[model samples]
Target: MFKIHEIREIIKLIDQSSIKEFELEIEGSKVTIKKSGGVVEEKVQTIVAQAPAAPVAAAPAPAAQAAPVQPAAQPAANTQVPEENLHQILSPMVGTFYSAPEPGASAFVQVGDKVTPNKVVCIVEAMKLFNEIEAEVTGEIVKVLVQDGQLVEYGQPLFLVKPE
Candidate 1:
């Protein structure tokens, strides 16, 4: 019989190693561990695994844009104006977007909320873990680009803000 301490030690060593999966059987007592790299990657992967919709959501935009809309019809001012005044905080990785830390929790930021560069704007829940997404721009949140539980792609815009 493997003691609890021994099992823990095995897990710790397995985590530090490059092996992705581990399984062992001794006298009918079995142990299995599936690793997803180190601690930071595990946290990020926990969220990304649930965001399979990310790629689907990304497709078709370019095709649709190429159909009927003339790029020249959009004035340069309109294209540049918003970007000049507003900054967007984009997702650092693909995940399911969440406005709050947990169910029934108050959202980290709402429309018109003032935020600093390091403020936590929202939490993105991927697999079963919630990763806090921060605001990299000091500004007032003008719009939220994603809904709660929405699947977001890496670099997808989450919030648009009017920079202070």
Candidate 2:
């Protein structure tokens, strides 16, 4: 049987690699893990075998669910300016978005704040991994599209920026 920490370590290692599926069998227990490309959704399956004379059974594990969908509201500023002139900072992976580094802390960037290419604008936590997201461009933040702790999808726009 694999320890909790060992399982976490394995997940971390797999998360950093390009492998899509991983399976391991130890003794009479089997573990199967699967993840999508650029998305953090994970489904883990475990199966246990009984004595040689008995039959093996596989139990289906509960699947991870994405955050509840929120209705999109149009910002007044977006209507005034042409969106073609603005740049969108998209989420690179599926995860929970956090504007602040921690609870009650000031957000990394707010609307009207200037950001450079390497400036960290937020964090996207997936499968217990906190990924720092950068601005990737020099611009003034025009709008924050997602709320804190909201689940974001891959390629979804998180911020709108007006290029400096």
**Top candidate when judged by TM-score against the true structure:** 2
Tens digit of lDDT per residue, candidate 1, span 27-138? 7565655554333222321211111121121222221121111122212122223655788787764457788877899989988789998899998754355788889878
- Please provide, for model 2 over 15-40, each residue's C-alpha lDDT reduced to its tens digit, 9 standing for 90 to 100: 44333345667875565555543333
Badly placed stretches (over 4 Å) of model 1 are 1-84
TM-score of each: 0.51, 0.57
Question: What lDDT does the true structure give each of the candidates?
Answer: 0.58, 0.66
Runs in model 2 lying further than 4 Å from the true structure = 1-79
Best by lDDT: 2
- Clashes per prediction? 3, 0
- Clashing pairs in model 1, backbone N/Cα/C closer than 3 A: 46-127, 47-126, 47-127
